[model samples]
Target: MRQKATSLFAVLLLLAAGVAPVGAVVGTGVEASAVQSNCSFPVTATDATGTEVTVEQKPENVVTLGPSEAQTMWEIGGKSQVVGLTKYASYLDGSDSRTNVSGAGRSYVNVEKVVAEDPGIVLAANIVSNETVQKLRDAGLTVYKFEKAKSLEDIYAKTTLVGELTGNCEGASETLSWMKDRISTVRSAVEGSDAPRVFVSQGAGWTAGENTFINRMVELAGGNNVAVEANVSGYGKISEEVIVAQNPEWIVQLGAFGAYPKTDAYNGTDAVKNGRVMTVSNQNVSQPAPRVVYAIVKMAEAFHPDAFAAANATTTASETTTTQPTESTTESAPETTTEGAMEGDSTETTTDAEDSTGGTPGFGVPVALAALAGAAMLARRR
Candidate 1:
C-alpha cells in the first residue's frame, strides 16, 4: 500500500539520520559500571572507538556533536562548560549563546566550525562518523565518542563517563540518584497491575522494536510493545495486517506529528475505539537523557492510573512525615480520566504533572479501561 511504502521510507530516514558511516569502528565488549566511583582528574577510559581517551584535567570548554549529548550536558549542570553544539540542541535554554557547529543538515557536522571553537574537549554521539572524528583528531582535538545507549543501564554509564570527562562528578552523582529514585517509584507503582498491549507509533507507521530505548521505556512503563511481539527488530515498520491481528489496547505516539494512520486496520483497533491513544514529546522519549524518566512515568500513569495514584499518595505521605513541610514540597499528581472514544482524537484526556525538577510535563492519557480490553483480547486469542 502507499501508506506502507511511506512507513518504510520514514524508517530508512531515521536509520540514516544518525549519520553513522559504513565500516565505523564499533565498540566491542563494552561494559558500564552499575555504580559510579570517585571522580579524579587525569582519568583514563576506553571510548566506543576502542581508543584510549584521557582527560588531562577538567575541561573548561566542551563541544557536543548531537542534541542528546547537549541535553546530557545540560542535565548534569555542565551547560556552562559547553561552548558549542549542533543547531538541533537549540531547544535547550541559553543554547542560542552557544556556537552552532552544525553543517548543512541535522546529521552533518561542521568540522571547521567545531575546530574554530577551540574547545578543551569534544563529546561525540554514537551517530558521529569515524571519518569526522578522525578529522577532528587530526586537527589536534581530543574527542570522546560514546557508544549507542541500548538500555537505561547504558545511559547511566554514559552519564558517568560524561561527568568523569568534564569533572562534573557531583552533578552526575546527584542526577543519577534522582533518576534511580524516580524509576524505583514507577516500578513499584505498576508492580501488580496488568500490562496492556501497547503500540508505539513514531509517525508514518514507524514503530520501535526490540533493543531500542523506546521499547525499554514501554516495558518499564508496564506495557508490552506490540512491535516486539510482531518480531520487528530495531526501528522498523509493522504491517497493517499484523497491527489488526495483535489488537493493541493502547497506542502511544512520539512527538507532535505522530498519529495513527487513517485506515481500517487502525480504526478498528481497541485503542482507537476506546480513546486509549496518547502522544508524548519526542525529545523526552527519543533522546537517551535523564529526562527519559518523564516519558516512562507518563506512560505508566496512563497504563495504570489507579496504581500510579496510590503509589504517589504513599510517597507524598512518607516524604511529609520524614521532613519539615515547605512550600515547594507539594507534589502535583495529574488526574486521569476517560473521555468519549473518538477516532484520531489522541489528546482528549491528556494531562500534565510537573516533575520534581520543575520541568514541564509531557502529554499523557488516563487509560483505566486498558486492563479490561487487554484481558478480553487475550482470552479471545487463547
Candidate 2:
C-alpha cells in the first residue's frame, strides 16, 4: 500500500506538470493566467505548481497570503500593490512590505482588513479555507488562489504573472529570460562534477520535509539533501543519531533575518567542528523575492566552494550588522499598510517613493473614489 501510494503521488506530480506547464495557461481564463508565451514558441518558464491565479486587467490593490508570494510580488516591482502581508514576510529584508493587517500566521488576516484595503484583487495561498475564499468573494473582492510556489520554475511563472497583472509583462519576460539563461549557465557549471554534500536545516526547526521548495533548491544548487529520508510527508527533522551517522560535509542554516549564528547553535555536530556550515538569509535563499537567482548562486557557492570562491565579496558578519532592519521594519509594520487600518494602527499617512523610472506613480481608481467620497461629504455639509 505504501508503494502504491508513493506511485500515485509521483503520478499526480507529473500530471500536474503536464497540464500546468511553465509557460502558458491551459483551459483556464486566458487573461487571468499568470504566465503567457514570451512572443515566441519554445519558451522556457517557471512551471507553476498548481497555483490557480486569475489576475483581472491590472490590479491596483493586491494582497498576498504567503511569505513567498509576498516577497515575489515585491521583487517583481509590485510592492505598491501589496496592502497585506503575513508576519513572517516581515522577518526577511523588505519582506514586510505591508503593515500588520493580518496576523503572523493564518490568524492575522481578517475580512474587515481585506475590505479596508479595498483591493481589486487578492493573491492568496492555496491552503486557505473554503470559507475564507467565499468570504472574500462575498465582499466583492477577486481572489487569485495560488499554491505555494516551490521551484525555480514556480518563481519565474509567479514573477511573470505579477508583471502581467501590473502592466509590466515586458519587464517580467525580460527578467525571466535573463534568469533562465543564468540557470542554464549555473547548471552547466555543476554538470559532471561532484557537488558538496549539503544539509539544510530550517533555523527554527529540524530539516525540511519532502517536496519542499528547499528540496528543489538542493537539486538546483547541485547538493544532496539529507532530509529525503523522511516519510511520504517529504520533510521531517531527523534524529541527532541519524544526522551524526550521515555526517554531512556541509550544513546550511535557513533564517529570515540573514543567517543566524550557528557556532554555538550546532555545537556537538560535525558541521560545527569542521566549519562546513553556513548561515544564509531565508529572504535571499527561500522567499520569492527578485534576488532568488542570486540566492541560487550563493547556494552554489556553498555546495561547490571551489567554483564560486570569488562570490564571497561581502562577509556574513558585515551583512548581518549593516543590513539589520529591525527598527525600520518594526516601525513600518504597524502603520504603513492597509493592514494598519485593520490592526487599528492606521493614523498618519505618507506618500510612497516616486517611480524610479521618473513617471507618475499609479495609485489605481480607488484613490479617485476616495477623493469623490471626501468631496461628496464636504458638499453635503456646505
Candidate 3:
C-alpha cells in the first residue's frame, strides 16, 4: 500500500508539475502535538486509511487522502475546508492555499511538511500507513480512517459521512438521495424489460465486472454487463469466444480507454459490426464526481437509442420554442486539445486527467499508464 501510494504521488507530481521522479522515501516522525476543543461529530472515528483519527473539533484544515474522496467533500459544499491532498486533490478552487505534503528520507513532504500544513484532520484512503497515522495522531492531529467505498451503497454512505465530517450533512443527504432516486427511476424504466447485453471497458484492456460501481451504473442504464456474465472479480480477461458467443449490443470504454476499438475487434465482431461502440468522459461516469448522475442520463440515451433520440427531439423542440438567451460565459468555442480521439490514449477533454500523457494502452496490454488522466482512484472497499 505504501509503495502504491508513493507511486501514485510520484506519477501525479511528475506529470502535473513536469518534475522528474524524486527519490524520497516515505518517513515517520511524531512532532510536538496539541489538541484543541471545537469538536462536533463524534469524538473519534476510523478513516478509509484504517487510522483511528480523532477530532477535538470540526476540522478547519483537512487533507483528503482517498481516490475521489475529495469529490465527496466537494459535493457537500465543503471545498473550502480541504487544506491538502495526497495528489490530484487540487480540483477545488481555493485548494491552492492547502499544503502538498510528501514523505521523509526523501525530498517529498516529510513529517515536517505535514506538521507544517497544520491540518486538524486528515481524510485518508484505505491504504495509508498506520505508523504515519500514529505519528500524526501522537502529534495531536485527529486522524480519521475513512473506510473504502466499493459499491453503490458505499458511495451513499461515503457521501453522507463526508457531509457529516465537513459540516455539510444536509448537502450529502440531498445529493445521495437524488442519486438514489435517479438510479431507481432508471432501473424502473428498464426493469424486467429484457436487459440489453452491454460491454464496458475501463483502464487498459479491462472490462467492468460486478465488483465495480460502473457495473451498477450499467444495470441502471438498462444494459447488462458482459464482463459480469462471467462473474469474475476486479478486472479480468474476456476471451474472444465469449464476445462472439454473447454478442453484446453496446461497447463502452470508460476512464482513459473511453474509445473501444470496434474496428480492432476480432474479425469485425458484433460490437464492431453493429456500430454500438461509443467513447465518453470518465469523470461523468466512472469517477464518483458531481457528474455521475448526468452519466446515467447520457448512458440511458445510448442504450435506448430511438427513445432517447425522440426524447432529445422533444427537448430540442421545447428549447427552440421558448429559448431565451442568457449571457453565456462560454461565448467562444472551447479550443480543441486533442487532434484525434484515440480509443485508449486520447486526453481530449480538460478534466482531471489532462497531463498524464504517455503510451497508448488497450486490450490485452497491461495498464501501463492511464495516458490522459492523473486522478487517483484508490478505493477503500472495506
Best-fitting candidate, scored by TM-score: 1
- Ranking the candidates on lDDT from highest down gives 1, 3, 2
Residue-wise C-alpha lDDT for candidate 1, range 154-236, written one tens digit per residue: 66666767888888876777677667666777898889888999999765576777866578789999999999999987666
Question: Which tens-of-lDDT digit does each residue in 1-382 have in candidate 2?
Answer: 5544333322221111110111232223333224454322222222122334445457667777545556556555567777776554564456454655553211435667877888867765433444555678789877765433435665676666656655556556555655665566567556666866567664323455456556666668777776664341343445655666566677776532112234443465666688776665444553443555665666676676664443333232223221112112121221122211111111011111111111111111222233233333334554
User: How far is each candidate from the true structure, as Cα RMSD in Å?
Assistant: 12.9, 16.7, 12.2
Best by the lDDT measure: 1
- Model 3, range 223-258, lDDT digits (tens) per residue? 888888867454455666667777778777654334
* Whole-model alpha-carbon lDDT for candidate 2: 0.47
Predicted structure 3: lDDT? 0.48
Q: Per-prediction count of colliding residue pairs?
A: 0, 9, 19
What would you estimate as the lDDT of candidate 1?
A: 0.64
The estimated TM-scores of all candidates read 0.74, 0.61, 0.64
Of candidates 3 and 1, the better by lDDT: 1
Identify the superior model by lDDT, candidate 2 or candidate 3. 3
Error of 2 at 144 (Å): 0.7
Candidate 3 runs further than 4 Å off: 1-43, 46-53, 91-97, 102-110, 230-232, 262-267, 284-292, 305-382
